[model samples]
Target: MFTGLSAFPLTPMNEQGVNEHEFIRLVECLAEAEVDSIGVLGSTGNYAYLSSEERARVAKLSVENAGNVPVVVGIGALRTRDVLANAENAQQAGAGGVLLAPVSYQKLTDDEVFSLYETVCRSLSVPLCVYDNPGTTHFHFSDELHGRIAQLPQVASIKIPPVQNDLAAAKARVAGLRALLPSDVTIGISGDPAAATGLLAGCDAWYSVIGGLYPEIALALTRAAQAGDTEQAIARSAALEPLWALYQEYGGSLRVAATIAELTGNVSQPCLPQPLRTLQGEARKRVEAVIDMLSLS
Candidate 1:
């Protein structure tokens, strides 16, 4: 199963489609940096925005170019059929695992959500992770729901979102999940700001966004936390506060990350959709300063 600091890369796109050549280069960079794994098409990868063909292409590109690193593809969709199709596509593309969130156009009942996963996973031979992202999906998974889903044959891991702005509460959430989930299942921390605390509190891995752009640092933090080295973990975690603060202020890490790639000359500026935009004017300068502060530039 995929674990540790799983870097979720931003899919570089051009007019025609996903920029295959440059995207592969980014994947190779993660491999060289020795990231524990690569998560393609995650929230940061804009899974909801891309076409099925684009997702399939990125999955193949990542798995092919990742060298020895495991590639986990995000396969969440509004419909069960679409999610199943995505799962099949990723599995066919040689993905290590697939991350699935219950994104929906309507509020889903607990039974509906549970059934959705049971149905989608029933057909897949590959292990799947339940992505309990309440913010995007708006479908909350209570502990009871989690227990029911744990019984599903293909459910191997649960990617739990950390409680925003409350690292201690986030730790408790992970602890609670550890208590409720099957012992064999791995618990990964996804919310960026709480990753260090969540890992220290006992989550097995970090499903990271910034780590996609800065794998070495993310790897350092994850390893330190895994090793129970509080000082190193705190140091690395503290270093990330500025950027994390921006994430909280701007309400997301997507735009901040996309802007960093542009400012650092990693790729041409990413084309984010409406209501979400890269940091601008003073906000842009502040982000650059934070990058310089962390020496990420």
Candidate 2:
């Protein structure tokens, strides 16, 4: 049920490992700012890197700290049964809804992918938002496949990552998909920079990572978009351009969370694990310089 600005909090970790205090503090700060909602244990939260026990702890603390705010858990995995199990856990933990990404890797046929989602749809009690992030998932759900899954009663929203870089093409794709689906189904646009673009195009909401680190700014831009104030939205989004630039420098999606931890001073060690590459030396200095330059808070 999240619409405007939903901040996806970074799951704080220390040198010794899990940093519950840091996580709590960040959540508290975001809550105080009154973001539209909080998405716990999403891609930004590094759910894939966490153990089952760690997931439970993070999910529980995230829910507890969120209080009355709507919190959606990202229940995603490489297999079917595990995704369903995670969904059940999220429901038990009192999440408002779930953002379910299709199984990453293993390129499946349309029928196979539809069947996987069908199982999750039938099992989860809360509403489901299908997350379309083909960049990492390997399998991009075609319009026909999306239509097939859209028939499920639990399907509440579609979080499209704007698969095609061309804004016009993206709009066409989203429009075509929307035309096939029911009118009430919400379409949430991912890719933060294009949030305003997506809003102008007819998506119901914007799923954001940058919003986690800068709730007020994100909210301001989201509000402007909702109000159809293009000039205001552009100005607000532009203010965070430097932060977005830093994200691009670091490589993949993990940089989004890592940058948030760096700017906010929440996580003890924001570096990614071995082989994944960590920011140090010149790289670390450049990242820190950008942070100092932006004075992002």
Candidate 3:
């Protein structure tokens, strides 16, 4: 079900819980833009920062606001039982599917990863997308482990964030994974800036951040790449390079905060969990410059 640009909408928060009103406005914008899918509670959604109850509420809210678009809720938690709980709630909230990642404080092994996914999958009737974001999870999956997870029942897709952004290198990686994965299983690219490269190389979707704020730009870029319009695709994605550089320089959390702030102003200012600061100094200035030039006017 994941295809084109899947907008990873941010869960903008202040001291008082989720700021539901602001969150609603953001989802409404995405619905109006007609993004391919709305992925709430992803790392971009700050799933780790909210409680299971809070996440369930966000899932239900997204579905209500999403209109014709599919809503995939992230169900990554530190414990297996917690993941199961999150999945149960998401299914109950009428979510189209669930995105899962091995969010761990302690390092996890292949067997452990398989069992966690297996447990969560067994409890739900909805499709599951394996979120392979090593930067957040700290659990890298070998090709062998990735293949094993793809075999699980109800598993429909794998979202891969490439270690390197080089087009040829990214293509080789997608080819290797495509060979091991079942023919029906979709390969999604979350390595944003490399997304054009990945889509050009045959990935089925782009799990995106900018799409959350600028879906029109995102879809145009996706269409270009999908139609083999190499120059258009590269140029469109290249226009996003400054923001991508900031995502690399700071992190997704910081840069995403900056992007949303530009989109919706101070209400969208980030309130990450302890030890993580919002964008400041030159980082914030760089985000403003990129947003000024590239954000929808």
lDDT of each: 0.85, 0.76, 0.82
Mind sharing the TM-score for model 3?
0.94
Off by over 4 Å in 1: 163-171, 273-276
- The positional error of residue 161 in candidate 3, measured at the CA in angstroms, is 1.1
lDDT of 3: 0.82
Report the C-alpha lDDT of model 1 over 1-297, residue by residue, as the tens digit. 556899988886655567677678779999999898899998988889888988898898889999999888999998998998899999999998889999999999999999988998788877888898988888889988998898888888888877544556767777777787788788888878878888888788899998999998889999999899977887888888998898888778888888888799877655454445678899899889998888887
Any idea what lDDT model 1 has?
0.85
For model 3, how does the per-residue alpha-carbon lDDT over 1-297 read when each residue is reduced to its tens digit?
A: 687878887787755688788778878888999888899999877899898889999999999999998999999999998898999899999999999999999999889999998888789898999999888898888888889988988898999985355677777888999899888889998867777888888889988876776778889998898898978998987887876777777766445554545444735555555455566777666667767776545
Model 2: residues with Cα > 4 Å off, grouped in runs:
14-16, 163-170, 270-278
**Residue 73, model 2, lDDT:** 87
Model 1 TM-score relative to the real fold: 0.94
Best candidate, lDDT: 1
